[model samples]
Target: MSKLKVLGICGSRRDESVNMKLLRYAGSMVAAEGHDFEIFYFDDFPLPLFDSDEEAKTGIPENVHRLKQAVREADAIILASPEYNGSITPLLKNAIDWVSRTSARLQVTDEWKGKPVGLCSCSPGAMAGLRGLYHVRDIMVECGGLVISEQVSVGKAFEAFNEDGNLVDERTSGFLKAMISKLLEVSQALKKA
Candidate 1:
């Protein structure tokens, strides 16, 4: 199997974000499978709140372009975010908004088309941030990303993971593995096709 480049995006600002913990766990698993899995945060790119006026005046920000490049280079992407009011975080939505736009004078926004994306979420509630994942799936699908059907959600996130970023429950860990494996398999198949 060809090693895949998997980009994991954590959409939370908390210093000890459970979302990031989930990504870290996934990253290790991806590595164990002999693939490259990199984790990134919105702050890593350091883009201001997306504003159309600012965009029209200055064009796309350098960070936006850089983030786009990361997405373009990856074989698959994992998005993990906590549910806020039953939806995705504003930070994540803002990033997507910027990345999906195009400047006829600058470039195109075709990067999202045909891209493979996986979704994951964790929350303290029993819902497990699943509600937010649905929203993410909708938004990515609208952007033309091939959102994978198999996703994972961890409830009681504060207690779901250990200091090592491993899920406490074996069954939950299996679900996470299945999701990542499916993502790798689909991405490899798409690359071949």
Candidate 2:
């Protein structure tokens, strides 16, 4: 089978964000399976708030273009989101909003169309950011992404990781692994077709 490129997107911007840690751990697992994994943190690509007038005048921002390229290149995407007020974080929503706009050169959503995706979330709260995954899934579907059914939600995220920043719970780890495997399987099938 051909090697697949997996992109890990973390919605949180904090230096020590639990969501970031979870994404890193997922990347390690994907790498061990012989797939290339790349992590994209929201903090790295600082995009201006999406504005139709600004886009009409300036076109898509360079950073947004780069982000769109990354998404287009990756065989699958693993999204690690932290719920904010029972919905997706603004940082993540903003990034998606920017990417959804049509560009002069590309349909924009074309990059996401039929793309395989895995959703995961981590939080200190009991919901484990699970509520936000629903919103994320809806948005991705609207953009034509094929979000996998399996998902991981690590609750009490403050204690979800150990000293090495690895997931401490076997169940959570297993769930993430299943989600990644499913994503790879679906992506490979789609690529062959």
Candidate 3:
């Protein structure tokens, strides 16, 4: 099997974010599959709130270009986000808006088309940010990406993970494993086609 590159985009930018911890755990599993896994933290590369007028005025920001290229090169994406007001976080939506746009100067067209995506969410509430993930799915599909149906949402995120960043609950872990497997499978198949 060819080595596929899996990109993890963490939507929460807070220090010691539980969602980032979840992505780290997932990344380890991706690595164990003999694939390359990289996580992108919005905090590390900040883009101004996406604005078409800004794009016309200043062109794509260097950081936006960098992220767009990453998405283009990635075989699949895993997104772990915290629900904000019953919807996806602003950071993630903005990143999608930027990455989904065409950039002729950078030779980076819409990268979301045909991209396979795995969704995950962690929250302190009982709902586990599932509602937000639905919105995420909508946005991803609208951008022409294929979202995996097996998504993992862990409630009480503060208590969901152990020190190693692995899910503690056996049932949730199983769900995550299935989701990851599907993500890897679809990504490899899509790459071949």
Candidate 4:
């Protein structure tokens, strides 16, 4: 089988965000699995809040277009989200809104259709970022993505990684490995289907 291209989206904006660090670790795991991985920091996209009027006049913003192109090129997506007030961060939701707008042009007919997805989250709280993953999974399904049922949620994320961003905890690392494996399995199945 050919190598798969996996896109890792760090939905958190903080420079030292635990969620982003987890995503980096996930990328490393994907590489070990003999697949290619690219990480997209949402802060890099600079997409404006979704507005149909602006889109009508200006067409898709270049940043939005670039993000859409990335999504189009990838065979699968892994989302690293952070929970804020028991849900997904607004920044991540805003980015999703921008991507969803292009569904009118692409949606189920073109790119992103039946794409495999893996959900993950990191938080300092005790919930292990489960709420954020829950929110992202629902949104991914709405976008016609085939979300992998298994997820990686890390609690006390502040201490889960080393200074170099490697996952230091054995249990967390194992969970992340399983998550990547599941993502790859689903990705291949979706392509075959």
Candidate 5:
């Protein structure tokens, strides 16, 4: 079988954000499985907040269109978000709003419809990344994505990795490996559907 094309979306602006490192590790895991993984830093992508007026005047932000195009092209998606006051970050929500609107090439229905998605989150707090993932999972569903049920919520993210951003904690590594395997399983199964 051919390799699965996975896209990792990091929903944080901090260059050293824990979510970014988590997604990077996920990409490595997918590569080890003989698949191709690409990381899309949502922060670096210049997308304005969704506005009907702006769309009417400027005709969709080129960068937003490109980001949605990437999402549409990918066979699977891994979204890594950070919790803010017990919910998904505004940046991620804004991006989702942009992608969910009607568009020329990548409408929400066709772009995200039935595409498999795996959700994950990272936080330095004890609650882990669960809350953010939960919020994103709902958004994915609204976009018609097939979300993998077994998601990951990384807690105390500062302690979850080494100084070099490598996952050093044995328990956390095992948990992440399991999550990646499950994501690959769902993604592979969806391809045959």
Candidate 6:
């Protein structure tokens, strides 16, 4: 029963991104559960493409440092992304790449290690960004994150939300809630152990 800090990350940088809405909705739900939830948008902390030489020369960028600190502080993460050509978006992948880099100051790749994560995505296509979650899950595993099995993928995202910006379908909403619950449960257990 310690308060859990959950970080929600939106992959899209567009002004009115469906994926960002999805993430915000999830954050609201998490907050309602009496946990601390904060949303992180890639738009707010843009970073250059990952470059080893640049990292060696100038070290991690300030934005990357800020992002890494956020990830480290959070007990769990929720990633909301849109599928791009059946894969994770470049913005999300680049953020992951930057955070995965070894930080000389920290001397450890601990930002994501053993942290619980929930995956969700929204897209107008039938696949609903599901394929992209596969890649994202793989990357999280490689980064030493403990990804929750339950997930949500909102298909036909253009019509998935109501005028109030809430999910229209009960089934999809249930799946997202269940995923977040599972993430919290697992993270709390890990913290206790």
Report lDDT (CA) for all predictions. Answer: 0.87, 0.88, 0.92, 0.82, 0.81, 0.89
Task: Estimate the TM-score of every prediction.
Answer: 0.96, 0.95, 0.96, 0.91, 0.91, 0.96
Tens-place lDDT per residue, model 4, 1-193, is 6699999887888977888888888999999889999987667667788777887777777887777778888888998988888887888887777766743553322345677888899888899879777888887788778888889898888888888888888988888889889889888776777
The 10 consecutive residues of candidate 5 with the worst lDDT sum are 102-111
Off by over 4 Å in 2: 104-109
Q: What are the per-residue Cα lDDT tens digits for candidate 1 across 1-193?
A: 7879999888787888899899889888889999998876665677788887888898888888888888889999988899899998988888777778876887857567788998899998999999999998999999999989999999999899887779999998899899988989999999898
TM-score of 4: 0.91
TM-score of 3: 0.96
Between candidates 3 and 6, the one scoring higher on TM-score is 3
Is candidate 1 or 6 superior in lDDT?
6
Which portions of model 5 miss their true places by more than 4 Å? 103-110
- TM for candidate 6 is 0.96
Top lDDT hit: 3
lDDT of 2 by residue, 1-193 (tens): 8799999888888888899999999999999889999987556778888888888787788889888889889999999989999999988988877766776554455578888999999999999999999999999999888999999899999998998888999988998989989999998998888
Clash count of each predicted structure:
0, 0, 0, 0, 1, 0
Off by over 4 Å in 6: 105-108
List ranges where model 3 is wrong by over 4 Å.
Answer: 103-107
The sequence of per-residue lDDT tens digits that candidate 6 reaches over residues 1-193 is 9789999988888898999889988998899989999987667777899878887888778898889899999999999999899998999999888877776674646588888999999999999999999999999999999999999999999999988889999999999999999999998998899
lDDT score at residue 174, model 3, on the 0-100 scale:
88
lDDT of 5 by residue, 27-143 (tens): 888899899999776656778878787777777777877888888878888888898988889888887777777755433334677888888888999988687778888888988
